[model samples]
Target chain A: MTDQLSLTLAALADPTRRAMLLRLAAGTATVNELGAPFTLSQPAISKHIKVLERAGLISRGRLAQTRPCRLEPGKLLELNDFMDHFRVVTEQQMDQLETYLSELQAKGTEK
Target chain B: MTPAPLTVSRVFKAPIALVWAVHTDPKHQAKWLSPDNPEGYLSKLDFRVGGTHHYGAPGPDGAIMYGTQTFREIVPMKKVVLVQSFADKDGNIAPHPMAPTWPREILSTTDYEDLGNGTTRMAVTWVPFNATTVEEATFEGARAGMQGGWDHQFGQIEAYLAGL
Candidate 1:
């Protein structure tokens, strides 16, 4: 878990790398395909992909010697779990705020 | 692959200006933006075009979630376009500590429409920006999870408004 978290962080540390990840998310693409939007060189895009590959966020496949990328959904579950706590806490506080607001409204109406 | 855009919206029983104020005002933002972590803090907000917003929340395990956003566009009591990212203390993009696959930067656009009658409808759209295949995959793959997260967070906010 720690490794994946750190790896994810490492991959995100660079903006170019992050854009590469977003490109892959749309669908699997070759280095050439992914580099089209940014006009980055294939080598530069490959370097970014390498970082993601090391992070285990993606895996490259060989199809007639052409490597393509695809989105790996598993790692996101880990992220969802980590972010879940924030959602829970926020909900609880909102409930409390609701009660407080109600009382305030009641007092206002009484006046 | 082109990243798909993600959007979420909520309605609040408050004036449009008040809702806009809450979103743009540092003091008001600090109050409710951290619904999950009651102790979440809003460190700073410079709510203008080119300004920035910085906020943090503690995780269940006590790890901190620090995030920042630079305002790209701002329309008073109406709309805000910003580039947001999880960041370290220095305001540099950082991977989410818990999810290595999450996107580094999420471009978000928030719009507030006045429905009149003291009601404001707010919408926030989040899109993965400058992400890698894994990062993008991580975000796209977790649609259900993201929905669930928003359900809880927004539900809480709805409840909070109901009481008012």
Candidate 2:
């Protein structure tokens, strides 16, 4: 079962797709312009685009024939909280690591 | 494409060997890894190739979640690779407490780099191991978000959010 968070995460998983999101973040871009920086073929680019669209990370520009894509970041908050939890844990661990290291060295200096 | 691995890297003020000690020695791990209550077995480390290090710490919501590490490889003062999985309080392998779709086993590799000038850099890489399609997809998705998270290394997420 593809949960919303999972879908968002999976869409962002690909380096190409993530970049596409980043490019879209700067401004909207048609599929062609989005595909310009990489060597991926048109179909491959389209496939990546589809994944992002499916995740709700981006939306198609309805009026334009070129069908530019814009970053739809509403779904990202969900993933952000998840990733934030991860970062907080890792950050806490680092803090502990630093404290413990100091204690270890302090003991070492005593010997 | 092979799914992206969840990675965390940090520079420690201590030397490499000292930094490695905290990870390899149960006593040291108990000291640093403890979030709230570290159970008895959590401190009891079987540090060997093919050894199991069962541990428990408070998850995000402050309830304890159990997990275990089966060491696959160990390079002195350099790297340690293991299979990381969720476990019951008894240390039996179990599904994730929060996300059942979460992969049961994740291949975890941690590298200790001697950054010279009396400092160490610890890098960790995590990827689902022996996972099914859904498991892999979940992991890939988690990792994709983690990249922005990683900046959160992968750094445009904040800007992307702000620009919107």
Candidate 3:
């Protein structure tokens, strides 16, 4: 089985799924409501929802006869954490490079 | 459809020659390439077109992860373009250890612009290389989420989540 991180990334690999998440970010919506913006069938939308749900990116709740899907921020937080590492790394590299260059220049001046 | 390539840029207070040399030199690359840890080392670096660069370090749970970059173009002191891939210790192409669906290869270009007065502007751009429809969509989605429109939506999501 793929790990949670991999599953989350795979769930987010689709434009339709991402669009659905964007809509949910504003507010919760039913399967029909989520499917309204796209030319997808109910079953197709449901499949995408299942993928998101399995990745723990969205949660479905029952409301009378309809099921509304809400975005779960926790999974996204994990993704943010993963991406932030790269950002930090890049910043650190740039800083180190600056220092390295300064030291190189200092040596040249001393020679 | 192909999406806009992800790009990041920075300006360094150094001459174009110095900046370019630091970037191309393996010794300097080893100092700054890995984001999380400096202990990870580059095993091989062939600084020429048609050559390959390999680096790896111990990953979570005792698994050593490897990265390979096959150089396609090298314009000294100006640009370097390469195809990046995950690889095994033997340097054979492999799926990314964490995200298997991640693009098998990414085309990366690094450009250096002379800013005069001993300063240089560097920009790095990345895009999926000959990706499938699904891979292309995935790359586009990830890039958007990280650096484009989805970035604003993410902020909204963060605020909404905080309210919950």
Candidate 4:
């Protein structure tokens, strides 16, 4: 039972999948359209697309007969939220260090 | 391939000696190293090379989440390097409580640069230590996604969200 963040990071680990996401960022694209830039075969591209879809990074829309893949901004926001944890930790630690230094200085002044 | 190290740098308004002391002293370490609020505490510390520092705090559900860092190098007032790992309450190495796939150990190197004028610049670098191929790949993927592609994706996502 992989978490959403683990799935998202695993899906993003591949260069080919990242390239597909970059292409989808522009606008919606069909399977062939998404695979146009890559030399990979149809099934290979499909596999990459499936990973992205599973991770909720992209979604496919049924427009008539053509299924167009579009980027899902919500998943990107989730990824951002995950990374922000480290930022918050770093900031909080720095704040605590500042306070500690001030207390040390105050002790030195009293001596 | 190994991923690029995650690096963070900051300048402190204190002297290099004071900054180094605060970082190495277990009493001072207990004051700031905890990530979440003030719920965590450093349970044990040995401020010497080859010594280990074990710390933990109660999780939201009241379970203890422990971590350890073994000192590898200590340069007085200048640098410190350590290998960090998650551990059980008994101080034995254990899988991360939240993310089992997280690397078992991370090598952390911190450099203290004296900028003069009672200020010190601190830079820290973190990399997976003795990781398996899968762990290395995961770290590489995260670094690639976070470092180079984040800003571009953020802009696109913001615009896309605004349009919705």
Q: Show the lowest summed lDDT stretch of 10 residues, model 3 chain B.
A: B29-38
lDDT of 3 by residue, B32-146 (tens): 5543455665568887899998877554344566889999999988899999988999888887554566678999999999999999998889899988765665566567667
TM-score of model 4 relative to the true fold? 0.80
What docking class should model 3 receive?
A: acceptable
- lDDT for position B151 in model 3: 67
TM-score of chain A for the candidates in order shown: 0.70, 0.84, 0.81, 0.76
**What is the C-alpha interface RMSD of model 3?**
3.5
Error of 3 at A75 (Å): 3.0
- DockQ by candidate, in order: 0.07, 0.44, 0.37, 0.42
Tens-digit lDDT string for candidate 1 (B1-164): 66556666666666676666656665554555454555466477777789988777664567777888999998888778898888987667777655666788878888889898877777777778777776775665443334634334434333433443
lDDT value, candidate 2, whole model: 0.78
lDDT (10s digit) by residue, model 4, range A55-89: 89999997877789999988777767656654544
TM-score of each: 0.58, 0.77, 0.79, 0.80
Stretches off by above 4 angstroms in model 3 are A1-7, A10-23, A31-55, A85-92, A106-111, B34-40, B57-65, B162-164
lDDT of each: 0.64, 0.78, 0.78, 0.77
Model 3 CA lDDT for position A12 = 74
lDDT of 4 at A101: 84
Q: 1 or 3: which has the higher lDDT? A: 3
